[model samples]
Target: MLNHIIGRLSLGGLLARAVSAAALLGAFGGAASAVTVPILVADVDSGRVIYSQAPTDPWFPASITKLMTTYVALDLVRQGRASMDTLITISPNAAAEPPSKMGFKPGTQLTLGNALKIIMVKSANDVAFAIGESLGGSIDNFAAMMNDSARRIGMRDSRWTNANGLPDPQQWTSARDMAILARALIRDFPDDHDLFSISAIQFGGAVIPNHNGLLGRYPGTDGMKTGFICSGGFNVVATATRGGRRIVAIVMGQPSARERDVKTADLFDYGFAQDGGNGPGLDALPGSSSAAPPDMRPYVCGGKKVPAIDEGPGAVSASATTAAQLVGGAAASSPSLALAAFSSPGMRARTLPPRAPLQPVAVWIGRSPAEGQQILAQQAAEAQAAAANVRAARLEAAKARREAVLAKRQAVQAAAKEAAAQKQAAKAAAKASGGVPRSASAYTSSESASMPEAKPGKGLTKAKDAAKPAAHKPVAAKPVAKPVAAKPAPKPAKKAAAKSDE
Candidate 1:
């Protein structure tokens, strides 16, 4: 089971882990992630912490959020507002949640008990959303209830913005807070406690297994929950009973889900070994309730944290409780299947979790099963009709898109044909006028060629001839008779004789 779960995490879900790691380190200097992951182990019988590390640091809760989500639903049942058989209808908003979902269509209806099993077994985000909507009228209203529950249970450092624990930087919890939540579930809702131990739920023709690997991989591990996100690596709050001694162990900010399990198992072993003093009460631990929630996104998802971040004393992280801006950055988004590969390849478990008896929680919508089914059938019909209308609308839209495309193509072809016709008309018109439409360059060249060539003598007259039309042909000159030269010579001799006689 661990192998199956971790295989999903390592495949592609951990991309954000590295990127978020880098940003967190840079923002908080170098030592932030080293101190933020909170771990707490407590003796359930005594409500005393056996061991703790960074118990008050705030971190993302991931799907461990379902614990509170389950608590709230069970609380409603105990309050007479709802029941184990309560039918939760999937709304559009709930259906829209990302994967790790049950993919139940809008208007789909099921008993609250069955929903709990599926979510606990499969960690379905959509079902969690639906559960919240069904309970407190809306997720927001349910969240208000969750906060109230957290306060009542002394989960001092936790805040919930969603039911499924998807990425919202604002959603945070601490290891101690989770332990508190786990203890509350154990103490308040003992009958419904088995929901967390379900190994798998059969949905349709397939089986969706629980995300918690410890259930079947560790000894004496009876029940609890596991969660992961990029910023908050692998987180698990596990509990096991051995020889009548029960210990609840929490491990957070693990690099992998497998590591989270191993650490948790070890903590439980350590917890059971203690016969000594039970530590302070969970809420009585030394820490400010107002401590800001630390963001581990950069370290976990940012792809930057190394195998080892140096451990050191707290730096400037200490700030006034009122002024602390603990918006833990880069909190885990939707983890892919690759986060915590179940086991390092070929690893065999020496001790697997003890099998828990199947105990289904029964919740109700204040109606008989048959009456509920009738109402559900009616709702299903309406939903189906609505879906048909939507499909028709979509088909109409597609037809419109295709028609628009075809019309655009036809317009382009028509424009091309009209341009060709206009060109032909222009050619016919030019030919009828007996005038060739020459371009400026062509006309200039023709005029230049028609101009007469100058005689090449040095004069302003020759310069003026340079501007003549290029097309002009020079006329051939006729040869002058030789008598012009003989007459000039004769006149010159007569003039010379007259000058001599004078």
Candidate 2:
């Protein structure tokens, strides 16, 4: 079921006249200035516009730029240049984008399919940038591809400068251009329609819901995208099917997400009420007079009271009184609904019900499911190894400190022992030299020979005399002289002594 109808929408001429600018301004909080937002509704099958309001006016695309990003990626898949499983690495440039991001670190990788799901559901800027880099080798290159595709697809009023649509003065698109692009995406990739309808995506422990409030809130609503910035307010490109007929609705520059959602629902009600009407194709829409897109910062973000941004967890639902207060007092609580308020003669602000429970689709990082597991396991193992190395280093440092302490202790003991030995040597030298003084350096020579040595019983004065030899008298020489003369007498005496001995 593919329809390549480019664009032709019947502008609700009577309907436009009935919904006066004053009425619209009252419904939009009765601000001082009445901002004219771009809106268009067209049948997907016949490519005929059911209702339109300044659809050709240029406006900031905001995050809806991801639709073009997605188309470019899907086109790559169609041309066989890449596949869904192609791995996209989050470079430093991607990781450094502003919030509404995935916070993936530089070098973190995920399959192109997972990345697409994240950007669609989470409106993640970082992931979108990474996808651009992966597909086109750089963001500038990817933007070139986007412009080339837009021109080729008959989108007359759109320019893309960045992948994530962060505030760039150069980037803008009109309701007509966005609708045509949406039609191309739907017609070109019938099998990939589910990509736009994802309710939420489960990434790791986090479950991020899609920002498009009408997905579950509105009955026939199926797939689409929503975007917001201070300068752009809120924008949405939504599609729905009813009674075997599908239609696309584009709303841009709403004051808040609540108005954006309510207006879209009202447009859907009007679109389904009509059969394909006669009108010019999307290409025939007149270009805007202004060269630059309107800056809605004053209306959207000025003053003390700022409107609810689109990045919140859920769509804002207000009671009738609260809604009246928001839109500068319109109506009281009643049984009437806000869905059909815009198309009716009088518009009233109403509250939306709380969103349905999220049905999360699982997304993981890597080239494949098995590869993701392997990468996780490898990371765990590396973390463990790093911890072990830290422990080892600590132990090594402690051991070195203990060794130094022990070496210091040993040195102290050795010094004490050497000191004791020296002291003993000094004492011995003092005793031998009669208590003569000496230093540690005097061990090489001793004065014991010149000094007196004290004995245990004798004093130091008698020690010299005790150490001297005894003197011999002069009788030693007389004994030798008398020996010769006494020899003759001794011989006679010896003879007598011998006779006596015999």
Candidate 3:
């Protein structure tokens, strides 16, 4: 009964529902089922495949295409044709790429290291194009170099049509082929693999988080690429280390981000377990599954279509509407309509029509004084408003500061006046007491004067009281001397004395 239930559901069907449930619930806890999606897990140290399923089955690579771009770049560095610090200039073509891009304006410059970081973190399409243009002078020429490099590196079943993999039906790759490329990158540029391990990259006030979830979630997972497109689904080439063994796992056609990560986690768990003691050794795993027979079945969705991958200079013409405007307008109506349109063969063909010729607009130069005057007046009004705001702020600040300063000054002056009054009262009291005002010059000096020394029996009552015992011991009571009368005036006093004698 269990076998019947398991056999009733295809691996693809089970995965679709599992991915849906995981996305909604944020976890997966159902019965374990074998993952039938094409994958390749290999040991990076020995260039050995540990486990693989449909490793050679062809599938769209999406932005995983950037791995080849990096491979080509590193090859240039290895050949001494370029340095890792070289600066690449953004061109108009590069600036025109859709987002999930570093929206660097044309003529903007970034170092090779920064460009690679943008590619690894943001998966920036513009940076990829700029690198290609800088390296090969054009993306077309750069793609040729990429394919040649791939062939040289023994990626026998791989092809590249663009530097930043925007959807082209022709941009197909195999899991085994991607694993081979990943091995080359690690082996040839061990120094730069850290670029892939970066979790977040900041540029131009925009901080792009890496799409590869393994960087933070998986213990030993380090470097590689993740990719997605409507047709390609989600894919990743992930590297992890456990014990002394390093392995790379490639998963393609995952239904969603969570599924992709969970599936990758399972692969890592299995690979590590095998490394510990369970399964076959790395070398014993199948070397190369058969290459997918060429996709000879003609595309039947649209009227008999040419198989030529759209390789022209431009695939889509700039409409009267910008990409954002078109997408927004479509989304406002049906929400899911835009996505549905992209999936429809007819809409894709129409929307991505061949590039149109550049149309020139007539230029009218020279303005009348009145027109110029009007513009000047508008600018002057704006400037006046700004200046007025600045003046108002300055005035408010100055007023507050002035009030504070005034309060501080008033407090200081009141303190000074109080001190002066106290000093004046002290001087007046000393003068009233008939004491020779002790050291009047010292009192007037800014330095506070010490109290004068008290004389014996002088005005310091506290000292006098304290010295009462001493006061009694002092026996010098000098008699008060009255002024002597004049010899008396003369005769009157003499006559009085003669009478008394008779």
Q: Evaluated with lDDT, which candidate comes out highest?
A: 2
Cα lDDT tens digits, model 1, 1-502, are 3233332222212233433211221223455422434667788877787766577877788888999999989988999999887888899999999867767778778888888887777778898999999888888999999999999878878899899988788888887888888888999998887787776675433555566767755667777877777767777888899998888888777656545665465455555656625478786887644456555565555655432211111111111111011112111221111111122231213223443433333322224556655765776799899999999999999999999999999999999999999999999988897564434112122123333322223223433444466678977878874543212224443343333322
lDDT of 2 by residue, 442-470 (tens): 22211234433333333333433444545
Cα lDDT computed for each candidate against the true fold: 0.64, 0.72, 0.61
Candidate 2: regions farther than 4 A off: 1-35, 303-310, 316-340, 343-349, 373-502
Runs in model 3 lying further than 4 Å from the true structure: 1-36, 276-502
Model 1: residues >4 Å from true position, as ranges?
A: 1-34, 288-290, 303-502
The predictions' CA RMSDs to the true structure, in order, are 15.9, 16.9, 26.0
Better of 1 and 2 by TM-score: 2
Selected candidate, larger TM-score, 2 vs 3:
2
lDDT tens digits, residue span 1-502, model 3: 2212221111223222333211111111265322234667777766666556566656678788999999999899999998776778889989998766756557766667667777876687888999999999898899999999988876766778899888777777787788778888988888888877876764323455677766656668788888766455567898998887888998766544544665465556555644433334333444444343222212111233422221111122211222224345443332123222222323222322222232221111013334434644665698899999999999999999999999999999999999999999999988888755454312221111222333233323433344356656667878987755433224543343333323
Candidate of highest TM-score: 2
Error of 2 at 262 (Å): 1.4
Provide the lDDT at 134 for model 1: 88
Compared to the true structure, candidate 2 yields what TM-score? 0.65
Clashing pairs in 2: 8-49, 9-49, 10-49
